[model samples]
Target: MNKDQVKGVGEQIKGKVNEALGKATHNPGKELKGDLQQAAGKVQKAYGDAKENAKDNVKRNAR
Candidate 1:
């Protein structure tokens, strides 16, 4: 996977943990932040996936 994909996955996992921790601590703000981070990570991962697919297509067409 590309850097963005890897990073995004990592961020998503981290965000999940953060969200869980916030829930355990009864912190709504933290939970919200974590949710936002998770969403951003998902977007980043999607972007990486699209980029990778485009690259593969270009290579295939070149050959």
Candidate 2:
């Protein structure tokens, strides 16, 4: 996977952890931040997916 994909996945995992921790500790700020981070990660992952797809399409067309 590309860097973006890797980073995005990492962020998502981190966000999940943060969110869970926040919930357990009863911290709305951390929970909200985690939610935002997770969303950003999803976007980043989608962008990476699109990049990979486009690359594959180009290669396929060239072939």
Pairs of residues clashing in candidate 1: none
lDDT of each: 0.92, 0.90
**How well does candidate 2 score on lDDT at residue 10?**
86
For residues 1-63, what per-residue lDDT tens digits would candidate 2 score against the true structure?
A: 788898888889989988998999999999988998899899899988888998999999998
Error of 2 at 45 (Å): 0.2
- TM-score: model 1 vs. ground truth: 0.95
Worst 10 residues of 2 by lDDT: 1-10
TM-score to true structure, per model = 0.95, 0.96
Which candidate number has the best lDDT?
1
Residue-wise C-alpha lDDT for candidate 1, range 1-63, written one tens digit per residue: 899999899889988988998999999988988898899899999999999999999999998
Off by over 4 Å in 2: none
